[model samples]
Target chain A: MTGFELPVALFLLANLAASLWRVLRGPGDANRLLAALLFGSTGVGILALLAFSQTPAATPLLDVALTLALLAAITAIAFAQRAWQRGTDPKRADD
Target chain B: MTSALAFDLLLAALLLLSAWQAMRTPHLGRALLAFVVFGLLMALAWARLDAPDIALAEAAVGAGLSGVLLFDAWRAIRNKPDSGKNAGDEA
Candidate 1:
């Protein structure tokens, strides 16, 4: 890795560490969910950077980032839909 | 310590802290949030370890998918009639 890459990646990791507190101490699920979302974007960034720095085939790694970005949104949407369904489904047997 | 090592150490500490909270918190909502945060931190950790492939997978599968699943579960539980009766209990 380049001289600068190491430090940049390290700083990103440190910030991620701080974010952990919010996940642990959040008052509600909304906070936690947002934290997880934050992770998705951050991970993509860190991965893209590392890929470009360390690997020759950095192009494919970008696909991973793109997939992550797309999937993260899908996950949030799916959860919202399920939650809405559960909220509206009065007849859910298990409750 | 070198900057990289210091960063790694900080990431490690935070990962442990968040994981602990995610697993141990009494409030389900807070626990879920912690879990999501933990996943993200884990992705970072993987990147630091020089495994971008794993990092990407962790971000997409672990953080993205798991966070949604946990929140969905929380919402379902919260919306239950009995849950309303015990709404005062945040846990």
Candidate 2:
């Protein structure tokens, strides 16, 4: 069972790589931020898989996954409430 | 065994890719977003390297706190027309 975990983790990583294109091709900041949220969740999944894959089972990784989940939530909330403003073009912001 | 190595290789590639995108992107917000992604990936890499403590710290400080700070900076830079214009000119 432990042996199966690594491939599953790899699959999740591939999924992340594919979704990353959306983040990269973003027409807006909000869209890129949404992709970042997806990264946070997918990251949790990968961490959980890695936790179980080890011979003795590295349960501490579960704690890491939990922290990641919490951080991801905080990031989304902060972005929605504080960082992003409506009608603000990030491209224009630099110019 | 081979699969584990494959996972590591892919993670490393992603780490490099995100880091590169973070540095190369012209848009400040996009670069910041890439940086957040890079931090999260770095945490995973730490976990894979058998450093759970480092992974925890990387996730909390690197991704969480740093992301918030960068966003604040982005907002501040956006508000300041002179600096924003100068940054664009330099880029």
What C-alpha RMSD separates each model from the true structure? 6.2, 3.2
Model 2 docking grade: medium
Candidate 1 collision pairs: A23-B34, A32-B33
Clashing residue pairs in all predictions, respectively, total 2, 0
Candidate 2 error regions (>4 Å): A90-95, B84-91
Best by TM-score: 2
Report the C-alpha lDDT of model 2 over B1-91, residue by residue, as the tens digit.
9998899999899889989999988766677778888999999999999999999999999889888887777677766867657433233
Local accuracy of candidate 2 as per-residue lDDT tens digits, A17-55: 888866676576667767767977899999999999988
User: Model 1 TM-score?
Assistant: 0.71
**Candidate 1 regions with alpha-carbon error over 4 angstroms:** A22-33, A55-60, A77-95, B83-91
Per-candidate TM-scores read 0.71, 0.89
TM-score of chain A of each: 0.70, 0.84
